[model samples]
Target: MSGIELKQLSEKVFYLPGTVNAAIVLNEEREAILLDTGSDKDHGRRLKKACDNLGVKPVVIVNTHSHADHYGGNDYLTRNFDLPVYAPPLEAGIIQNPVLEPIYLFSGAKPLPELMSKWLLAKPSRVDHILEPGALELFGVALEIIDSSGHAHRHYSVKIADVLVAADAVFGINILQKYPLPFGQDIGGQIASAERMADVGAQVILPGHGEASEDIAGLVKANIAVFEKAAKTIVGACTGVAATTVLKRSCEILGITIKDLPRYYLNHCTVMAYLSYLRESGHVELALQDNELRWSAAGN
Candidate 1:
């Protein structure tokens, strides 16, 4: 952990920053509760070393969701220490059976080989506890779990003191710029969660990725804008077009290129979520003609 030092966020909170930010919160007894491990075992080992440097033992892990990058390090940490893993009810199932990620991404069919990479599949780890949205007490530290599902079904965000581990509920400004549409399994829920984060009352917010900031309101606004922009683009693309055609047109308009199956399917699933949201909102309609499903603006 030469360059990977645990940066302090508060009197009791520290985090190791990487592709995903893994937080370390110290209880009264100095036991650490990790919030979301990084993308793989190397991240887990580095986080452990960082903990050793800080003179604290990681006694528990709280995963915000089932995404591979967020929970990928759970197997390493669980194997090295007797840490109890806590995750939202639905997400825990996928955390234990990670293949479900690519399976669902491929529209419930057997995923192609390209979809089996570590970006989408992580080693299975045991989930010893299930988390619900509410107050939680662990290792003598008080935590508030907020239901922020939509990015992944049943994703939860954690609040410790004035610091909120927002998870993927709201992406950092850089993340928003990196992936215009981001990723959402439920676009409606995603938009609602982004709106809710503004009222969460946390002075400082730590995203699962990117830098922490005090501008919670600004972050929430940016996230909602991205969701709405994607929704508008998808809606415009649905002019009696097939799903693939809609995805292509939307990506082209947004300057997004899908050169691999992983990127393609991630965007495809997200676009499908947008369509579902628009259709449910009565902004769009779908029809089956000649065995080809077509989408168009409602009443058109």
Candidate 2:
């Protein structure tokens, strides 16, 4: 709480950041609608404490996406508040069985124990409501569920008044900031998602990983250029390139120097998944030529 800043966008919407951003919406009757819980088990406790400190009980929980950091506190919230949870309909299937997808082991700094990791996975659960883009009512405030799926393919950004919970669709490791995260399932879609949120024209853009920004539209525009260029580069160079070669080329193309993280971490491992997914999805093709593996994107 030392560096954390909790900003009230209005009586209905509050922006609180600690490790991640969470939103609190107040109903006319003073109940709360919570969005995107933090990254650990204690998040709900902290949330409840914050509520007690502020004097309101949260009665609803909305997960903008299914990532561990966003939904990790689901177990806690449901147990404590009997809140009805909601998610994008497309993702409810995965939510029903939230496995800590094998992909994260390669990206996270400290992986969960096998037993805990298995349990951390999403359980097949019921969503009280499934959302679609545009203005919708929740608690007392009017909310918007805008599709911003590039980060997770099923991610959504929650908007209340002038503030938008950009979710992972537009925040976290901005690859443009560094060696961009290998975590996305689709680079192209991720960039598109960023643009969609920006276009929503919010005054305060609350992202998933970093500080809130006012010029989110500009940020999205800039990163889209980066994404498009990277996609073109990957498509252009692929007959199949070595993993090291790809990483090196990626570093150069993204205008960032890449320091490799551990393979078990989700960051590095997701690179492998991205490539495999690209190949499997027919966005790219794979082959072994001259005893060196290479990749080629499908013709534009």
Candidate 3:
């Protein structure tokens, strides 16, 4: 919270920097619509303080996705204010049941304590609205919901006032450099979404974890490049190897070390996504080899 400040990006759009970026869009009535809260209650409290400092009332919260870092503060915000929480379909389910995140990551089994940390599990909050892709008007501000599902299932980006609140459709360059795989449920959809983002008629793009940029095309291109590189690496490693082996080999190639349970599961899920994308694209095929699931280049 030391260097965090509410910076205005447009006429009425402002953002607060934290472990994740949260945005505030002011409407005609001086009320604000929050675009994703920060990671937890403390972060929510800071956001509230920032809003109060700016003398705007946060009347609603539109969550871009169900990832803990994006919607973790929903409970806090709803508890203090009678706020309406909005989320996309599948993501709404997870946001209302925070445990589902770790459960899904653990393949529907009981997750270990290490995987149930606050970073992975947030307090569940009620979703008052289920958002759909298309035009939406909240608090007198018109917004177009662009389907950006890939990073998370049912993730949507909001375009208001020529600024796109691109939740996780595109990661910041620093984040992409750090985590080459960048946690996605559908690699193909993620790549397509990144391409779609390039065509978004927006002057500014605010990403979930990094600073907003006016160079939307540049960011989108970088994101696409990262996705392509990861897909190529995963496909190359899939030469008659077990899925786990492919993940391990990809990690080695990317210089990623699984230091913790969360990291391991995140990377594992991302690798599975890559496999799905490759299989769909007919570049790889799966087989049962001696009771172990194996993946190899197609037409083998």
Candidate 4:
């Protein structure tokens, strides 16, 4: 980095490595406050290099969520810097234990090498300060922290100026391929979070992965509708069919073969977890009959 670090958005916001992004705020004497480390220790090293070049100390370090890919470098950051790492209180368990970031076991997306890479990168660390979903006051920035807790209750998306760091609140379906910019979420909390963003009326949106966009409120709302409709359909099917049948139907509807998807049944695990969440929330009900899991919307 040059003597002056580059800002990605209007001002005071910069892109960190991987799926990570951060906001820089100037404190009383004018020091920078950093937010969110990327997927690995390399990102922390890069941030330190940028700090060394900039001749300033970052007064704060905050995580946007507890996802491994989002805050895996916290160990490196905490060890090297004297700043406090703030995260949502609900995320403290997983951030502290790391085993709670369990998506890795099912993603089926990352191969063993990639998994090992993530495992090596994911060293546990403690949160020095707790954060809730609310506006935060720092040196020079008034951060509007919204409880965008659908992707994870452990998540918060920050808003500054006209930009909202959407952070998986809305994303493209095949985000990793870097194409298909549809919102990839179909869950209750995710729907509500997108609606919140729509209501906020930000001109620009930044997703957890992939590119940023200008004016996506309508799309976010549309994706929310998709979630509701899909949820209803899933719950309905559960009433009459086995889990495997539902999974097969879902695969057909989504236009992919099980063999072609991530080997670990990531696609299946996602639905299973979503169903589990819905069942626990009283939105859906399930029973094991004939040696197969069956489901239905409550009272249906």
Using Cα atoms with residue i matched to residue i, what is each candidate's TM-score against the true structure? 0.98, 0.77, 0.97, 0.77
Stronger candidate by lDDT (1 vs 4): 1
What is residue 257's positional error in candidate 2, in angstroms?
Answer: 9.0
Residue-by-residue lDDT tens digits, candidate 2, 1-300 = 221346676556775677678877778786888887776567767777676656778888888877666776767788667788889876665555565343344344344455235224543345677878778887667888888876676888888878888877765435356435335665556766877777776887777766677787776776666555655655554655775566566656655554433322444344554566566668887778899777766763
Q: Per-residue CA lDDT of candidate 3, range 106-150, in tens?
A: 889999999999999999999999999999999899989999999
lDDT of each: 0.91, 0.66, 0.90, 0.64
Number of the top-ranking candidate, with TM-score as the measure: 1
List the candidate 2 regions with Cα displacement exceeding 4 Å: 1-5, 103-126, 172-179, 225-239, 242-265, 268-285, 288-293, 297-300
Candidate 4 deviant stretches above 4 angstroms: 1-7, 22-30, 51-56, 103-121, 172-186, 225-239, 242-245, 256-266, 276-285, 296-300
Error of 1 at 74 (Å): 0.6
Task: Show the colliding residue pairs in model 3.
Answer: none
Ranking of all predicted structures according to lDDT, beginning with the best and ending with the worst? 1, 3, 2, 4
Pairs with steric clashes in candidate 4: 238-295, 239-295
lDDT for model 2? 0.66
Model 1 worst lDDT window (10 residues):
1-10
Q: Where is model 2 poorest over a 10-residue stretch in terms of lDDT?
A: 259-268
Reference-based lDDT, residue 89, model 2: 72
